[model samples]
Target: MLKIQEIREIIKLVDNSSVDEFSYEYEGSKIELKKNKGTAAPAPQMVQAAEEVKQPAQQAVQQAPAQTEAAPVQAEESKPAETTADDANLHKITSPMVGTFYKSSSPDADAYVKAGSKVDESTVVCIVEAMKLFNEIEAEVKGEIVEILVKDGQLVEYGQPLFLVKPE
Candidate 1:
């Protein structure tokens, strides 16, 4: 059975993705998610089957994605806005998925980029680990990094700003 936090993370991923439906089964437990047309996020259903022949299986419809939305809201509130007049020409490098931010490929390695670091469209600026996959994030714009928006190991939401770059 999946833990509550893990389930929430899965729900967030499904919500942020374009998939219309998703299903997973493990042991006797199953999870299903289907997106509602015109809705921004999908609703998930969790099912647990009892091993004992005499006991009835239990099914639950979980609508906790609304609660999960609050976490990202709080995170955004705590993050200082980068849209000041001086930063108007700066470009933002945003996370494409929800994950843990890693400044380096490994803890002992030097950070991929930092403040004042120059980068091109293909430069791997950092990594975002999602569901055990470390996605190398590219700068996508030629510029000098002006700031590192999120700290190492921080939980980042989909489309959250990860870096600020001053375009060349």
Candidate 2:
């Protein structure tokens, strides 16, 4: 059995390294970890044990191609002028952990903030539920909410942009 701290250490190593996927097998137990880009949170790691299974073997890790030439061309053509107009001045608040994002405290409660709402460093902008704990995410920046980037009850990953603010 792997300890929580050990798992965390592995996650940290994987996050810093270029490897996209890792797997290990010991005795009859197996574990796999995969990194999902752009989500800002690590995917859930799964561990399973099988009785009378063969000894574990290490699998070759396959690295993805660096980039495709066509992707950049499409991105450049699809970008609108307005996207870059105010983006330079906008502050983005991102998720600090992987969890389900909620716009309100409860199902019937009003949303914490919306477009044009004024906020400060301590303002609770939304809730992120992880391991049955509801974590209140703050603005951490004094600003006016210009846009909400995520939907209520959406699964948000660490570093995923949640809101766009026009800092005061």
Candidate 3:
């Protein structure tokens, strides 16, 4: 995984270059950055694209040890059966990019949402900071926030569930 500092440097270089997209791969990890031209701010957005990179099962097994360090935490994150059943009908608002999750727009501001907060598709529920740029994340689903899956400043992976909402 690329450190936040390294991502920032890449963003700086890409912002200054003529290229609108940049991609890099090392070992099994891949990073792709794209710049949206019409946005008010010219910040590069990091997006994960599906790639067909097949590796030997032996190599995959060898990498398991390095990846399994977070297994315990992941196991702990699993919801109880009852809770899982209750939330089965809920909608998940997921991260579109890998970045540090932020509950509020600024350090002094109140969080955009919390448990029981009602939101519509256009509602900004949180911010995810990538490469020093704060990107406001919309709820996308019409519902009431039932749970927050990530803590403030936590690094989140692409497609990770950030909020669970009880659909309206």
Candidate 4:
């Protein structure tokens, strides 16, 4: 028989490793752990180009003619670089409280800030729903989003890094 803590440790170990399947048996008690290959890490940086609330409209109104084609290429090139940013120079937007994180004001609306989206101290970066109340989370630093650390509708813990930003 395995203790609860031991089982939890086993699960974490299996989840972080490359092994896709695991099984164990002791004293007629059996345990099995499997990683779901279908679920890509819940990171949202890959879909950033399609996100960005108030970003596209603002950019289109300002530099549409000059950036129309270049923006698409930039997005593709940045995909590879997004994974290698130096965290030492980045500002992290962390969850202020334990709650469920939401990327938009509503399900159908665009996300507040995606990779490459610029943000200021007052910018609403995400929503944290706690105790039936939706609290809007703000980005307190001025910067461009370098990565989105949390997935939409995911549970977040207090002080968990939600987004990584490169200061402007």
Which is the leading candidate under TM-score? Answer: 3
Mind sharing the TM-score for model 2?
A: 0.54
Candidate 1 lDDT over 22-136, as tens digits, reads 8988876666667687867544544444243101111124324565466545545665675455556889787655678999999999999989999998899999876665777
Error (Å) of candidate 4 at residue 111 is: 0.8
RMSD of 3: 13.4
lDDT of 3 at 102: 97
Q: Kindly report the root-mean-square deviation of model 4 from the true structure over all alpha carbons.
A: 15.7
Residue 140 displacement in candidate 2 (angstroms) = 0.7
Q: Over the stretch 30-79, how does candidate 3's per-residue lDDT look in tens digits?
A: 66677778765443445323232222111222333323335334623586
lDDT of 4 at 57: 19
Q: Which stretches of candidate 4 lie over 4 Å from their true place?
A: 1-85
What TM-score does candidate 4 get on C-alpha atoms? 0.51
Q: List the residue pairs that clash in candidate 2.
A: 40-158, 41-158
Candidate 2 lDDT tens digits, 72-141: 2333344477864776798877665556899999999999999999999889999977666677788878
User: Total clashing residue pairs per candidate?
Assistant: 0, 2, 0, 0
User: Comparing candidate 3 with candidate 4, which one achieves the higher lDDT?
Assistant: 3
TM agreement with the true structure for every prediction: 0.55, 0.54, 0.56, 0.51
* Cα shift from native, residue 112, model 1 (Å): 0.2
> In candidate 1, how many Å is residue 60 off?
23
Candidate 4 C-alpha lDDT tens digits along 1-168: 443235445766777888887887665555555565776431111011222222321222233233333433443355466454476688877665456899999999999988999999889999987666577777878989988877899976544678888998
Evaluate model 4: give its lDDT: 0.64
Error of 4 at 157 (Å): 0.3
